[model samples]
Target: MSGSFSTPTLSTEKTFTFYSQEQGNAYAQARPDYHPTLYQTIIDHHLDSNGQLETILDVGCGPGNVVRALSSHFNYAIGLDPSEGMLTTARSLGGTTSASGLIRYEVSTAEDLGTTLPQPILDESVDLITAANAAHWFDMSLFWASAARVLKPGGSVALWTSGRNRIHSSVPNAAAMQSALDEIEERHLRPFFEPGNLLTRSRYVDLPLPWALEQPIPEFDESAFFRKDWDVAEDFFAFQPEVNMDVFEKITSTASPVTRWREAHPDAVGTEKDVVRMLRRVIERHLHEAGVEKGKEKVKGAIHGVILIVKKKI
Candidate 1:
């Protein structure tokens, strides 16, 4: 049930770059961490292709979640994001790098790839470059060119994002609940969605690969490209299989489109007319119709996921 598509666009100043300290904190609290298998799959694939594990650069690393989680595996870990608020949150949640190395965060963009940082990343030194749930926000053609410069000859680039979601079959009146969710997306969120959101919703099938860009980056080995997809039953989201309504609401509120909607209708926020609150009311009504006791209802949903892994030419 996809809507209209837009040309892929970069993460613009008008969007996530506007994230304030409070917004970033709320984002960190609401978003689910990537599943361990997601990381391991990237690592195993990279290792199988003889990729090194010395320096990692996670682009668009909001809240530094990926870098912090993968810190122990690499000697040096660097996270870059355009938002200072997100970087600040990342720094506060400090994690350890290798004994002889350091963990750092820089306010930077995927297009920059740390070249303009006070301490620029070493050219051809990064062993793994990752963009988790963030690549759709990039100008991929530019990102690939920058990746070529920052990555070692056999380094790997891993990009992953979850697709548009659905209510899990376990939820009461799951079909009707899904329709309500879809209705919200159509009536409330779609208008505010940027092109990047469309790409993620398409599971990156519409995203450009290095070789497919206007000025193709030949440094990547398209022949060895790797992609994996997980369906609703495949556990890609890694969020709790069950959650209370309040927790569910927080999760739903973190969506980029919803953020845009809230921004546009500040007065409606928290009122029954608010998109989130409206969703809650509908959900509550569904629960009541399904004979759920007050405060006893739970919500769980399914989202497809896809990961794209490309290796720099050896």
Candidate 2:
């Protein structure tokens, strides 16, 4: 008889529920682009170990940043996301696909990977599956099951995310600017944080996996349905985000919690009563007092990320 078990009800989906087209566009525009080396490192290592690395699927590919960057390496790249707003911005702003390879965007969630993909996309055909800064929002059980079903014999899965942003500047008031930003998060935005923020803060290290944690999952039986399981977590430090003050502010404005809060209290954000606005003003004022003008100053920020790669048995 078939059995049933409880599934965890954990998600940060609501944080994105309030994503309007404007916010989606802002996210696509203001967010820092991942370093090319991040993709190069993975592609180089995969090519060295495996043979030709072609077709790729980027799950929960909000605004399609990873797809646009990584598509050239593969013959075909597919970006899947549940949000139409995000997909809209992704299509509009992600630019044209290259002549060598192309990217296609789909409106689907990680859980729907099995059925939502085109009929022509044969099972066990995908070469690589990636989730860039998105795995935290996925229902891992469903995602992993679909991944196992769709990936080729030796195909790989790469999941990564980053968080804990900070500001750095050459000016003397940099500490005050950093402090103001920290207060905006801890003091103002803390109450608005969705449960998903916890997962992001932890860099998804404690995320669920089907394989046994204590010992290796046993080899597949005669059924030969399940592939061999192997997984590793790699950390990428020294991921600093350098941008102009304007871009930095734009990035902060794209914060989901802050955006949601502003949506609820529109009057606060536009007027003097707005905490986010106030936070931005405080930083701006501090910068000005430090003899650095807005739009003219450049600041660096911190971003810590981790990649989890799982490979099926050959």
Candidate 3:
């Protein structure tokens, strides 16, 4: 008999999808891009394992960044997200393939795959599927089932997300600075974090694999599953080594918990009392205490990133 367990239900998948168009645009602008090495690693693995580059589907593709980045390598690329607001921003920053192929941006949740589209994605047509910083919100059971339905025999799935943000080692009193940052999350943001957030926080260690399901999907090769991690010291996620408090404020505000906090305290949205604003001021004081001059507090930040790739057996 097989035991049964469900992946943690991420609220954002249903009740908390992006509330407005403006919010989605802010997210695209504020978040950092993944390092080239991260993409290169996925590309190399796909090609090495005889995966085709004809078509790629990026699920949970907020603002279309991952699909946009990978479009140049494939003839056809489509990005799907449950949030129409996010898909709106994604289309605005349009991308094309190496052969100048257009990228399709669709408003469909990962669980639905592209089956609901007017031109529904044909079964066994996708060559590669990717989810970047967005997989944590997926219903993995539906995700893997639909993924297996759409992927070609030799296709692969690549999923990646960052762990908690960390103060770069070079920052003065970095240990204390790190502690200060942790305190903000502990005292304030903790209340707003949804269950899915923990998946990313833990670097997806507990994210279920196809074979881990109660009724395993036979298409994926359990033997071909792979995982890789990059520490905070690694230059693999955000390219910038440091960001001043203002930029830090912007980045932090893009987080889901911050958004939720703002929702709960709408009156404080733009003021000093804003959760992220107050957090930034605390960091500023930390910098001053560490002897960093005003307007020169360029603290380093690094995101611990992890990627998992699994191939479909031919």
Per-model TM against the reference: 0.95, 0.79, 0.94
User: TM-score of the candidate numbered 3?
Assistant: 0.94
Best by TM-score: 1
Worst 10 residues of 1 by lDDT: 1-10
Could you give candidate 2's per-residue lDDT for residues 1-314 as a string of tens digits?
01122223213376553366776787887776676666776676556546256688888788888888878777778888777778888888553333564477876778667365564356787888888767766767667777777778767777776655555444458788888778767877888875556666666646665463233332211222222111211223323444555566677777767777887888676576666567767767887888876666566655556666666667
Residue-level error in angstroms, candidate 3, position 285: 0.9
Q: Per-residue lDDT of 102-123 in model 1, one digit per residue for the tens? A: 6798888888798987899878
**lDDT (Cα, tens digit) per residue for candidate 3, span 1-314:** 12232444333454336546788888888888787888999999999998999999998888888899999999999998878888888899999987898899987877889887999989999999999987777778788889999999999999998887778777887888778778878988899876668778889887878898767888899988889898874656647657887788888888888888988999999898898887787778888998999998777777788999999999
User: For all candidates, what are the clash counts?
Assistant: 0, 1, 0
Over 4 Å off, model 1: 1-13
Model 2 local distance difference test score: 0.65
**Candidate 2: worst 10 consecutive residues by lDDT?**
226-235
With a 3 Å backbone cut-off (N, CA, C), the pairs that clash in candidate 2 are 268-274
How should the candidates be ordered by TM-score, best one leading?
Answer: 1, 3, 2
- Candidate 1's TM-score: 0.95
